[model samples]
Target chain A: MTDAPPPAPPGRHDRPLAPAGGAQAVSELPVVTTYPLAFTGQAGEYFRIWIVNTALSIVTLGLYLPWARVRQRQYFYGHTWLDGQNFEYTASPVALLRGYLIVGAFFLAYSVTANFDSTLWIAGLIAVLFFGLYPWLVMKSLRFVAASTTYRGLRFRHHGKAGGAYLAYGLANVAAGLTGGLALPWAWFMQRRYQVQNAAYGNAHATFRGDVGDFYVIGLTGLAVGIGGGVLLALPLIALFFLLGGANFPEAGGETFTPGLVAGLVGAYLALLALYAVAWQYVRAATLRSVLNRVEVGGVVRTGATFSPWRLVWIGVSNALVQALTLGLATPWAAVRRARYVVQGVQVRAIASLDDFAADAAPSESALGEAATELLDINLGF
Target chain B: MTLPAPDPLSLSGVFFDGRTSRDRAATLTVSAGEAQLRVDGGLETRWAVTQLRIDPPVPGVRRVLKFPDGSRFETADDASVTALEARTGRNRALGQVRRLETRWWTALGALALTLALAWGFVAYGIPALARGAAKATPRSVLATFDRETVQFLEDGGYLGSSRLSAARQAQLQTEFRRVTAWAGGGYPYRLLLRDGAPEDAPFQLGANAFALPNGTVVMTDQLVALARSDRELLGVLAHETGHVTHRHGLAGVYQGLGLTLLSVAVTGDLISAGTFAAAVPAALLRNGYSRAAETQADEGAGRYLMGTYGTTRPLRDILARLDREDRNADESSVRGGSRTEDLLQTHPGTAQRLRHLRDIEARGR
Candidate 1:
């Protein structure tokens, strides 16, 4: 005899609710956002945390750099607010570590194989081979991370498919290349779109860009040279030593000097330094202006612009020199500069009025201290 | 007669699920005698529409009509057709409602399978292969490739190679140990130095070096002499050792095997065992990997330099120098016999590698 059919499993069989995709916008249920449906807490707050971490990184002369990025991303996302509430961040350290290890392992193997093999053509062929699938792999990895996020009364969603901001950014990059850097501002805009597209706060989209005053009138490279050169010039003894050579030694008779060599060195150094200063000014101006461009926000769109790289580059160079001279001490200035750069760029498209809306005592106030939809989960156990 | 105004259109019918869709129009031909609808949609398709039945508001006279595009419309003028014709769509293939005929269970199962394969290779394949090479190969046959390749062989060729003598192998082991100690107290490391015939001048034609499983690194004399400078030598060695510490060699074969299989699955083109056999020897004649892999290796190499030497700039210098050599030789014909084909290799561009190393260094410790 045929066995009777088993009953549908509980909860598993219940149909998942379709996305809130009807033409008519649905009014969300009234639940004070103890957590915003976001991966970060607040726009300004995200910047602050990133800045602090980035600063520390700069002090280390890039040694602590990766960690700084990780920390900034983690903190901003972990404590994000969702619809006035905090969303849960769920990325595990282990997952990130595993990814690093596996990818690292592959990287090494390829090196050896390539080293032993003489057919150099295979290198390009293989990269081309993987190029076709890179988008798919990125999509998979991104989606996995996204699916792991949660927000106020809604799970976070990822649109890491063959569409949207990625395409725009790609086009902008091509434009930038074609325009010989003239299209940087437009490219910067595309980058803003890419960043904010993933940001969500109670279904309200948020975005950002470099501030109007943030860009450097000079190019980023130019600005770097200017600040770096100016700082170097300020230290007479240091400048003289570098101008002569990094080898600073006690002088015989209060000042031992070689006229021709010293004069020639000084002349060449000043010439190069002067050129660098001029270029730095332009680059610095351009970079700041580029970052100061506005951040745009809308439903399904949220991101920010930042001009901090020029500051970062200048800080790093100065700090690197300081380390070179002092044997790695007194690097806080560099770190601070680095931190500020990243912080300025870290935007959170949260519910625009979140902090203001959280005027009354509410659970979401706890969320203000957190980020949205990333790794940290407020009340995750529940 | 002016074609009776086409009847008002309605998207009332259920649509079919299709996989292969194209944004194009097509013609359909049907024959009653054959009782078949021939859809000339310029694409092969399969479709499905289950339980297609229509109940009319009222019974009506049936009608048949024809259109000028050489088409016909057959239906009751007063009644609607409750027909489910596998949901017709032009230039679209209806994905057969499938029970996920997937080896995704197979693909998801791949990780475990790969781990198993990796273990097998470690436990059996590597030793067997090593033994085979050592047995069939002569230790005295040091320079494996033609002498013309020496300049390009970065490091010189293998030392005398009837097969590495037990004594020489022991000595090689000692040197590897020293380099290993330099890298760190104890990291995953191995050294495989294929000592070449000293006859291969300047750059050993048989030169090559790579890290193997669990810290095994192989280097040929060709690689050593090929480095025009001491720093370049150090850079090359450090880069290889970097692979050793990272266990790149082992991971690579594992990954390559997976990718090659995937490539074959997607494109039914198969490389014969003979092709691989030929390819291996030919590939061994040069030092290169797929561009993506090379980039990864460069990064790994850079990291190793950064971590071990606490400086990575030298690597950038070395790569740039080598790339210059490669590029200049071809352009100036300074070297008579350099292979033009090698320039078109799939390995990451030399400039790109140098840039990668620089970027890595800039990323900091």
Candidate 2:
């Protein structure tokens, strides 16, 4: 169980589905039921919503931004279903608008100060201030997002302490800095663990049992592949150029495949891209499997994810290329596809009955923190 | 005794009491203009149809209705929602959104229009607005930026101490002034000379001459050395002066800022970290001015060369040499890493710039 599992071969067990309601097993027997999460969003459907939102937002000079955000969130959440019920996003746009305004005002004041006096000191001061506020903001954002996300009339909740958030974010930052950024994997794991342990679905608190070693494995592999593969990819291009007699050949070089500088350069670019894409895929797949499977809700419901790194990488590279080529018009389709792929890979195992569990919706959190984080360009919850 | 079929259209759904998470089967009865809910025959609630609060339905999802007392009803059944909508009237905004989603052709048209409008704004509207904003800004305000940037460069070791002797500096200054004398004393032009960019270091903004918004031009020692004649150096200075006189530097900054804000406004996607990440490269690659702006600058350089040297030949010659120098130095091996490494040069390619200069000379009397 310590080693990461191999790619799940396609079979009845490969893609998990929820157990049939009528099925029964003996009381003494151990039961492992897999519940498949579903994303039913369609690109064509989302495009209409996006186009209208974009048009209206521009028409109103960005005043419709909050509403647009809410609509988009609602669409995505509403389509994500587990056990015949969907999640709901129930935030008030007016609150988010207020948060944006406050954040805007703060930036305005800072800009004025920066313009009139020494910018370096003022910028440093603002950075320090934001760093101090980071933990609090992350905590608030988590609570707000969790409280607003409803499933079957009950909102998910976060019970994590502010101290924990500070430990996760603040301490991680210091540690990463101290290690000259080499402690990134450890820091990432700690932050993720903190977030996961504090999550609650209905009445059950979540727990994370993942180790930092897994993160390092993925990180080291990514780094190794990035460097080794880059060199290997470049070697062929260089050799080809020398063989082709385009430029002066190396002292010991023998033959050239294609003797043109243009060919060699283009080939080199494509090879490098391939290496990067593959490296990123491996890291992403390994990380997702390690992180998600370790998160257990209510000590009964656990998640499982198994994705083919090569396939995931292919999707990512092609999706980016298509979006760029289309000048972002295909963004809706690409986003939906990516979400669908990730969601489809997830399987939830519940050892106990999930239908009877319940938790009351928490009171709405303040919008000020959420808005301020946005205007500060801090990506907290996405 | 069918009893009018129990209205036949009563809405059935799931009900929550707001105090508890237990879900119960619910039926919504609209009778006598009141919306009544009977839950598992255990709890009953009613509100006037007009007074009931309804959360707009997302397509293919549950519609939630809330009573003033905090209890709520939700159901994914389309028929039930339709019945409720028919009784209380549909939410106009959601209705429009739904219609747009279903009307494929209309959505397609809107998307096309949006893209067209965005392109138009980026290509034409932003530049025009930036020109206006630049003109409106005071020179003193722009000068503050100039001082700060130059100070920052000096502090960072990017601007090394000037290595030219006083006589050589004075000679070059005289030549610059003599070439631009036709502009008279009204143009607030100043010149500064600095060492070449550092070698074997990260920051490699090399062998460059550029203008600040405040009518100040910087020429590097490398650029001076690259010039075979004083006429060539003066030609470069005249070009930098054109940038200052036209306020292109300030306009460029304004255009970049304006486009970023406009992109956010149009997309309404502030939370997408990719939005900002993508913006950085766009700004870097868009550093070059439009063809028209570059042509204007080149013409300005040609005009100066003609006035001072009696021909634009020196400017043309220097441009060709610079083109050759660039070709020799274009050995940077892009490892296909960050997009910033491949950012388009802020000036036109040397060939294009030379062609434009030749065009200017051909048209010059």
Candidate 3:
């Protein structure tokens, strides 16, 4: 594919000085190239891997969990591609087992303490300890995931510190709670900024510049529309209630409500729920687009995505419905569809040839935190 | 010099030097001992065929051939991949997996088999394992669990002081002990009474009577007041003993745990919206075994009650009355049926249980 001319940098570009010794310098014209990212993994292919892994895991009575995890990650990673080179997951099963052992110890201790004490104070202390350690765990888990992954032989790295993670997660969450949840948009922005800014492939660092104002604008607008739609939907019910007057109201602790009134209330509640989910899906899509469009690698390679929220909602709703109907047997196919839709919409623009980037000699990080989270069933989904 | 003769097995493809973003036309020729790559620019490379690693095809992806020294030959051409596969036999494991995945009949067969096996595992395997495990467990361990569970309930306001008088309580306990003696010391049973808190509270366990695996039976004050006679109370306690003996509660716990793990494996990510969607039904189905357990418990109660009263009439009467009371109380909160509540109910419909009791009475006669 022919490269598109890069958009002017506006204000962020810093031009380097030309050579003085008569050597011809490369042109400053930005070379914008969008690398196609594709998910080549198929449900049929993955199913074989899944069935085998599951059978073995069952046969081994969960001892094969580490190997199962590695194989699963490797299958997905090895099929996802950018610029014709697939990403790879390099974490060993042994490392994962070590992580599981550490986590299992903590779980055992907690259960024992809770069982023995059976007191409110001990329960509170356990919850407090979990929250206190959560930020550091998140940071370590991200680092572990990044360190295990590679693209074109170059390792990816996560550079955020635990302190920064605390500010992004713990402090931001507290602020959101204190401000009657008005700070949620700002909290989301900060968290995304922290995650994106710290990610790098070899030496090309990513930058996220999406303003918090954009987050609040979309978030508040979505909330307003949701509330408005719900109220509008309930107008008929409210009208019906008024028309029937107070005497027809259901008596407390009595099953005397008119069937019509009960059905109206239930229907309105279900509609309101559906409306909320649809609105949230839209807000999520718009926010994801805004965040992804602002990411730049090395101040030269920019990435973007186009997401139609309506399409996303349909996909989300249908996936849930189908999965439920099939008793979760359709899960692999649903995952494939979602991944394909999202990946196909992503675009990358770089100012120069991507070949000059060299592999970094970064050491692999421990998968202990990730394994712990996995075992605990705490899905960060990073 | 004239070009070397083209081997009949030579396959044309594109090669990536592993250092640039450029792709060059190349031909891979596998000879007697070596695999050689000849690029368009007269650049030639050779590797021992044994040292070459071939990656399998994924949908919409290039098949890669890796050299020992780290260069790569990537091609979208199916011919090149087949040529390599023909030289080195296809991976047996992957090939088998691929067959099950790609062939329509095989995929269908696999799906059917998987669903059948999963259902059997959930329905029977987990419960059987739990029965074995509960039997193997020491009584001391079960006692500890029971003690801790009761303490938690009391702390959580789920258990309260019984409004029943001490004299009346003693009368009920005396009957319960007598009945157990008849069954040859069936259980080391302890009975606790709970007052019904207000509805909608976390501990709104309305008129419920349940037995723990360790032989502790909790009788709600509402249930005791609802009983017409001491014979009715004896019938309920006898039923609870049946639960303890069968280890139904422990089996239910194991089944629930197994379902959770199985769903996790199916969904991969716990955060998926589908995870909760799928979990609710599976949990309900697992608890659906409660219907069977209730039947077993009822039959046990019937045998004892018939021996004492010469009829299962008292036990059946109490069950029918309690079922009516529960329906009225539940419907008072919201008129008509809730689909979720109907789906999630662990116990058999009270009508169904009463019918089974009638059947037992019929057979005994």
Could you give the CAPRI-style class of model 2?
Answer: acceptable
How much does each candidate deviate at the interface, measured as C-alpha RMSD after superposition?
A: 25.6, 9.7, 7.6
Computed on C-alpha atoms, the DockQ of candidate 1 is: 0.01
lDDT leader? 2
lDDT of 2 by residue, B1-365 (tens): 22443353477777876655566789987765678789996788778878788787565556788888777887656556655665556676766666665567877777777777777777788888989998898877778868887887777778786688899999988877775565443556677888757654347555678778786778888788777788878888888777777778778777766665664553333344235446654565366444456667788888888766777666666666665564233212111223333245555665566666667667776
A188 Cα displacement, candidate 3 (Å): 2.5
User: What is candidate 3's lDDT per residue for B36-154, written digit by digit as tens?
Assistant: 89999999988887888876543334456778765677655556565556556765544344344444566456566666677787778777776777677677767777888888888
* lDDT string, candidate 3, A1-382, tens digits: 0111123211122333345664565656654566656666777666655565565565566677787777667767766667655666767778888888787666545544554444446656766877898777778888888888865555688898988889988899899999998998988888888888998877778888788999899788789879898788878777877776345555535655767667777777667767877777767777777787899887778888876656876887788678768766676677777777777677667776666664445767887778867776664423
lDDT of 3: 0.70
lDDT at position A123, candidate 2: 60
Model 1: how far residue A102 lies from native, Å: 4.7
**Candidate number that wins on lDDT, 2 or 3:** 2
**What's the TM for model 3?**
0.80
Best by TM-score: 3
| Comparison by lDDT, 1 against 3, better one | 3
| Candidate 1 per-residue lDDT over residues A1-382, each given as its tens digit | 0111112211111222454775564756332211112221233333333333333433443344334434444434433332322233434433454444444344335444464345445655655644444434433444444544533223344443445434544566578889987776556545444444553333433345453233323345454666676666557645666666444345445345666447756665655555564564345434433433344434322334444555555655565566446422233334444444544454434333332211111111111111211111111100
lDDT of 1 by residue, B1-365 (tens): 12343232222111111111111222222222112222334443321222122211111111222232222223322122211222222112111111111123432333344345544643455434533443343322212222223333324443444354688557656755655676662544555455554565464435455544344455665555455544554566666665544444444444444444332221212332123322343343223333444566577667667776676666666555455544223212222223444444655555556557768887875
Better model by DockQ: candidate 1 vs candidate 3: 3
